[model samples]
Target: MRDIHQVHTLTEAVLDPILAREPAAPRVTYYDDATDARIELSGLTLANWAAKTANLIRDEFGLSPGARVAVLLPAHWQTAAVLLGCWWAGAEVVLHPDADADLALVTLDRVDESEGVGEVAALSLDAMGTPVRDLPVGVTDFATAVRVHGDQFLPRGAGVALDGMPVAEVLAQARKAAARQGFSEVDRVLSSTPWDTTAELIDGYVAVLAAGASLVQVVNPDPAQRERRIVSERVTAQRG
Candidate 1:
């Protein structure tokens, strides 16, 4: 049997259990412009999308295992999904507002300029239209990649269920399952406070995404809007 130390990536740890579950079960929720979009992500869909996106990164930028990718964007459900996708592809993700340049340098491979900076790419998120650059290497526009790849992805691995289940119980089950699968300590993440305070991310997100029930990231502007987000989105976690 493989020991916890042997596990290498987040995809290997969580995919099987998720795939075994029902698709209609709610996996995550996001709030945009006062509207909430809840995704009932089955294990199959999550695994497939992550794999597809990972493949896109691999093929387009030649990112290998252990490469560092920086994602500078808001904490939406899709952002979380993309982070999982990066882990699935065997790469480390650096969240936005990262201040440690040395830490960022360890495995830096591709940087999505549309989100922030570290490297340059063809994609830009500016609505007013910024001038495009013709760079020789290291930059990518994530939106374009998703567009080119299309929405459908091939599924991989078996699935599990934590749907409609209490957060605590789901976490316990996932922890036991992950331990059996040989996933130990993954990373020490310092997420930008308040938003990162949720039990879901610390308990479920990081533990399930990274190996060994450990790991994890940011943001500002809008107090009244933030309050609405908490109430509408059901974010019961404490605000910093």
Candidate 2:
């Protein structure tokens, strides 16, 4: 595996290498304080989900390198899979709801907000892979939809990483953010930060990938569980 610094995108530099080197190691762990749910993914498993997502977007939605994918999802393990898939398919991720996109990835409640921008796929956010209930007639259920796709995929090529920024620039910024936060490959970071913007995405999400660090991302964090998670998850660093 090459160094993390030698990267075109996270899917190429980070995910691919991690899968090749430590396919069974826990790379990402997620927690939902509201539901009291937890999920863990190894590098191979994450790559499989990402490959399925890439296949869905590239084949079903006709998305390519230049296409934009609006992500209305939160910071969860599934979100990480979707984002990696988008990057693998060479689509630019749009965090802003107002942006035009070829695809919109959203949770069940945000269906109406993704209108006016291509196709929409709703996520149930259920760890059990349940299909989202009451999805609109045209809207696709992400968990069910993504499952039909094959786990093997070839890159369509890479473009901008997020919004209008170039892929190289976005990754470089993420690397800097990782360094600023003192991230290292051996660290397991527990993070509660929201990736609601490009900057936050770089700081909270991409930085972990850039540094080749393991992640324990929490949403709706329960304060009481933080200490327990740090010990249980063997977290070496904290990020918010």
Candidate 3:
């Protein structure tokens, strides 16, 4: 067996353990509507989705090991899958703002044009159907990239280090934050904010996923009803 040092990406680390686990275990749950307040996913589903999407990322964008891929998406199950997929493929992921121009510019400067960077992918969440523009040279729509790449799981190096104070530890801390926000096995998550929103970043995105709960994103939810739905739906988690 190869050592953890031989491992190359986040995707590899997450998927391997998930695959090794029993299929009956809960892994991921996708919430697209408000009908359900409590939802959970099995471990098998999360592993399969991560593998499929990771394969798509690899084949479509030609993402290589240690490359950085920026994500601009809402807080949906697909978003989590893609982020993990990128990591599985050994690519670094930068969460980017969905609408702020200044932040977008800063993110671009920080991530784009850097040497050893891989493809930069964008996701359009505009309700106005506005055209996406001004993306960096290699930037492509994430959906298009996935569609172009067939579903296939190609294993990479060993996996990420489970050693002292590693990235996984950081993820664990994020999970603890989610639990503090009320996320539990029986609760489903809904976000009125973007996935990259600061509040969602610290509390909802990583935390909800770590808690193994389903997540839903309301792109244009009414501000008045936002809190009501969150409470009624038992959305234990919030972007705080």
Candidate 4:
């Protein structure tokens, strides 16, 4: 595996090592409450999704470096793809839909109601990442469009920072936090905190990635099922 120390940006520093060292290792496991849906993405698979989403943002939307893309989805696997993809496309990610942004990726319900968003894309988050059958006039279906794109993406320039913090600093802080929390490569970290905010970027995703650990996230979790899953998945640490 490439040394995480040599990487500059969050994308390269956090994700690339996992993809290189253990491409097939279980990286992210997600559970949704409303539908009792479960989805898992390995290192290679997550990279592929990120790449496709990057292509969708770069090619279809014509968004380049310095552009802002608003992400309005919950803490699903696809949200991870969209977040990484935005950084891969050299654009900043805005968490709020109303922020000044060039494009917006949203859930199905928000497609019709989100006004003033430059362009709108919808994600179904189905088992297959399916596209909506009847999208309102101009909304792009993310899942369908992403499938046709390439599985790998290489940005032309160096990595960029978010929220005025250098990417390297962000990783360093995450590492310190992870150490304090007793996280390590041997641990499977379980996080129930909503990964929709900027705080989660550091505390949830970065911390786990920095430790070379995997994440088990439960959305709308049932108490009984959560206990079973923690044991089944061998989760060692938790953040709720």
Best-fitting candidate, scored by lDDT: 2
After superposition, candidate 1 runs with Cα above 4 Å error: 1-6, 33-40, 96-139, 150-204, 207-240
| Prediction RMSDs, each to the true structure | 10.4, 3.8, 7.1, 4.0
Order of quality (lDDT): 2, 4, 3, 1
lDDT of 2: 0.85
- Local distance difference test, each candidate: 0.43, 0.85, 0.52, 0.78
Winner by TM-score: 2
Q: Candidate 3: TM-score? A: 0.59
Better of 2 and 4 by TM-score: 2
lDDT of 3: 0.52
Residue 190, candidate 2: Cα error in Å is 0.7
Model 1 lDDT per residue over 1-240, tens place: 323233345555555444454333334433333333233344455555566566665566665554565555345444555656665555555543343211121111223222333433343332223433443354445555544553343323211112222223444655764455444443222223332333444343545443422222223333556655555444433323
- Writing each residue's lDDT as its tens digit, candidate 2 over 1-240 gives 333223365478667667766788888898989888889998889899999999999999888776889999888899999999988888889897854788899997888888887899999978889999988999998898888899988884676778888678887888899999999888899999998888988899888878888899999998999999899999999988
| Clash count in backbone of candidate 4 | 0
lDDT of 3 at 73: 54
Best of the two (1, 4) by lDDT: 4
Model 3 Cα shift for residue 215 (angstroms): 2.0
TM-score of each: 0.50, 0.93, 0.59, 0.89
Ranked by TM-score, top first: 2, 4, 3, 1
For model 4, residues 103-191, the per-residue Cα lDDT tens digits are 88988777754678788888887777667878888888888888899988977433344554556677788898788888888789888
**Model 3 C-alpha lDDT per residue in residues 1-240, reported as the tens digit of each score:** 545446545444334544554455544443444443334445566555566667765666565554445455555555666666666665545554323111111222343433343344554423232334565665554454455444456656423311222345546666677668777655566665565643455465656555555455554455666677677656655552
Model 2: CA > 4 A from native: 1-9
